[model samples]
Target: MDEKRLIEQKIFNDTSTYNDIMNVPYHQSKRHLPMNQLDRAFQFAPFGALEGFNDLIQEKTELYERKKYTTSETELTIERQLKYLQAHSLKVDVNYFNDESGYYEHFKGYLKSLDWKKGRADFDELSVAILNIRSIKLIKK
Candidate 1:
């Protein structure tokens, strides 16, 4: 036979060699156990690097939609309330806009002092900028 035919005949007719390779058993670990269903499932699980991304998006969305307390009517009302508090030295609750975070925060205590010239108000221990004031209300008496 020619060289090509002889090589093909030798390779294709090696059925015993293929049979031996197929019958060989896979190697098993001595100490390590085979993966269970849960462990095997984890191997194919998807991975993400940006954790808490959903929460961050939700926080930003809420911040963007938040209402401001700066309308002219609201400003006038708060100014009147502030004057009343200062004149009476009233114990009041105050909700003021926090410019740094663009949100409202509250303080309920005695009105210690008012500095209209400086545009600031002093509570029991806290000094707040008057321009930041949103609402003021007399508490009990």
Candidate 2:
């Protein structure tokens, strides 16, 4: 196994050790610690907060992984399609291209004009359509 994989596996297998490493004295000492009853409350407060933050991080990591996989697949599909299009001397839609500011402004206008639910549905549909088109073109080639 690779070093990164090995380290991740170790962390997973020994969660206590991972927690201990993360909770090193120097790090803990840097934080503000309360006194008496307030200390207990503060300590428990951070535990709950940290748990919530960890959950959010895990969720974001999963999302990032999914997006990365999708992006890589889409890029490969687009590259294959471009090659095929070149070979066949087919014209590509130039309307897809827009300057960064123009694209952002379009979306900003879209957000301002549409209802939240409708805009979200449209976004999902467009995303799926783009991915499907690229995937299909790649498979065809």
Candidate 3:
């Protein structure tokens, strides 16, 4: 009836079973696993518990977003700055927006050419859309 007695009786009943199991000597497995500590750890590692959840959070919490539209005054300012860039043709840091992701990103380098036809400013191995241009400031060397 008491918890102590109940446990004592159960232990007494299982004593033979425990003795049978304990009587045997510990035996090594015939085939040994080749798993290292790192591999064993990897097996229990957390994996894709919420796949794409982190990416979704990152997208929502992005540092910058593209403007809905550029103002007329801002457009004029950019045009003047671009002209200066063309005349000087100096290595500059360009801040621009990505149309696809609607996020602002920047790079520092020399312009390969200003592609007016394609509406993209081309750099060595990189190009950004003209419409997405935010600000271009000359990087003084």
Q: Highest TM-score, which number?
A: 3
Instruction: Say which candidate scores most in lDDT.
Output: 1
State the lDDT of candidate 3 residue by residue for 33-52, as single tens digits: 66789878877878836778
Per-prediction TM-score, please? 0.46, 0.22, 0.48
TM-score of candidate 1 versus the correct structure, residues matched by position = 0.46
- lDDT value for candidate 1? 0.78
Q: Which stretches of candidate 2 lie over 4 Å from their true place?
A: 1-70, 94-97, 100-141
Candidate 2 per-residue C-alpha lDDT over 13-126 given as tens digits, one digit per residue, 9 for 90 to 100 = 876756757866654555766367976787778556565787777765654442322477665765465445445543233112122212211111010111324311122113
TM-score ranking, best first: 3, 1, 2
TM-score of candidate 2 versus the correct structure, residues matched by position: 0.22
Q: Residue-pair clashes per candidate, as listed?
A: 0, 0, 0
Stronger candidate by TM-score (2 vs 3): 3
**Candidate 3: RMSD to truth:** 12.5
Q: What TM-score does candidate 3 reach?
A: 0.48
Per-residue alpha-carbon lDDT of candidate 1 for residues 1-141, written as tens digits (9 for 90 to 100)? 899998998898868767768878998999999989997887776664456888888876676465454788877887788777767766788888665566788888988777889988888877888777877877895
Worst 10 residues of 1 by lDDT: 60-69
